[model samples]
Target: MKTYTYRHPEAIEHTGEVPVMDEQGQVILYSQRVYENYLKRTFDKMFDFRYFLKYEVLDSQREMLFTVKKISRRGKLWFEAVEVASKKKYIISYENWRIGLPTLFITDRKLKIQLEKEFEDWSNFLLDEVEIAKWKAEFSEELGEFHMTLQIHENSPIQQPEFFVGICQATLFVGA
Candidate 1:
């Protein structure tokens, strides 16, 4: 399995470029958050309603890899991600509750994935009851930031790993 870490300032609002690094501390991808207008940007900063913003993931060469946009946010958070080259679409739904951890659902045209935070600060992506990926979150008081780690099993069946990373980025943007 390979481990990747993404560390960012612990703030409700994020903008500009954020880096995702490998276990070796090498940046593998950059995620950028963009708002449609100044009003939406200010609203996002003041509240948790991030449906007004969009996210873009770029490679080392600053080439756009994929884009994530909010599709709905009434009771649950829904997002749509499109790969730049293939134009493949992924639908991600997050079910939030007043108690307990939220549940994340990711699906493409055929495959469906269910991820639930069964423990505090830890979540696992399960496909047919088999664990394929693990996600862990830690807060650093010294740096006043949050570090998110994702570990993908070597034999994982998932094809596009970057799409999951993009979903993670969207979750971070919405405080999910």
Candidate 2:
């Protein structure tokens, strides 16, 4: 087998955004795209909160789903109505209620699992058993594909360099 090296004469330089052609010779991908800045200001306002939040929507009538939810509970409660949409959906139409407990289990052991299970059990409660199964299947797929950037801002903050930038790429292709 012949080994290829990038700088050697044996290797071909990769031009950015190589065009992929179908059988009909139609261009499938190009370096250029018509980027519409429409609603960017509106979108920016949505993210105007001090805390960072974003989500990549996998599917819907909306091209990309974006929402900022402020969690509120009526009073001290085990469970609160965070969201209930379409009369049968757990979509984030409301805020997730939570106790003022640290996410990290520094002083509490059951807090993490309890919080997770809260959402899990709540999911079942929101939908019928059959609908829950189907919604979970689709939502799980979306969950796997859904990638978001989040940074927990610290009130007592310190400057830190980004560690992942210019590091590497790991390919994960499990399909034929």
Candidate 3:
């Protein structure tokens, strides 16, 4: 299995670029700044308080793979990943968390697990990280398994993707 690290570049103007790196520290995919106007920034800070933003995930060739948008509605975080070519959207929204286990809804699927600890920093209400695993039944002929893990370096000091992580992860899971 190959490891992927999400990295944020060091600089004021370049901080918006979040790169997904391979084990060799090479960027495989990256998030591009879609819109960051002065009015949007000021408005978000003034009213929404950083509750909405948009970005694009591009491959190494800079072709758009997905358009990611995160918005807060009625105190719930809604993250959507839209495939550029197909326009298929995968959405994940925060549900009523129970006993420190976050309830996340991906369409009709509800995922409530402690493995999502790393993503807890995205909001103060979350308490765990997110990990994905694939399982197959020995007797089944039509089961597909898709597993992905994100590995970050200790020294890179990158900001967590927040709801963007769910958008990327859910897209990979549901889209694949």
The local distance difference test score of model 3 is: 0.45
User: lDDT-based ranking, best first?
Assistant: 1, 3, 2
Clash count for candidate 3 is 7
Best lDDT goes to which candidate?
1
Encode model 2's per-residue lDDT on 1-176: one tens digit a residue. 11110110111111122222223444322211111243543453464421112211111132221111222245422211111122211122212323321121101121121111121222111111121110011113433321111121232121111110000000000000
**Selected candidate, larger lDDT, 2 vs 3:** 3
Which of the numbered candidates is closest to the native, going by highest TM-score?
A: 1
Model 1 TM: 0.84
Better of 1 and 2 by TM-score: 1
Candidate 2 C-alpha error for residue 73, in Å: 11
Q: Which stretch of 10 consecutive residues in model 1 shows the poorest summed lDDT?
A: 167-176
* Candidate 1 deviant stretches above 4 angstroms: 46-49, 73-76, 96-99, 159-161, 173-176
Q: What tens-digit string does per-residue lDDT give for candidate 3 at 1-176?
A: 33455533322123255666667878778765455677776675554333445667777787777777666567556667566777666575554442343455444133332223223232211213433321111222243322234533233222233223435433222211
RMSD, every candidate, angstroms: 2.4, 19.2, 13.2
TM-score of each: 0.84, 0.19, 0.54
- CA-RMSD of model 3: 13.2
Candidate 1 local lDDT, 71-164, one digit each (tens): 6545665789899999888887777734556677878868788877643476788887888888876778899977888888876776455666
lDDT of 3 at 157: 22
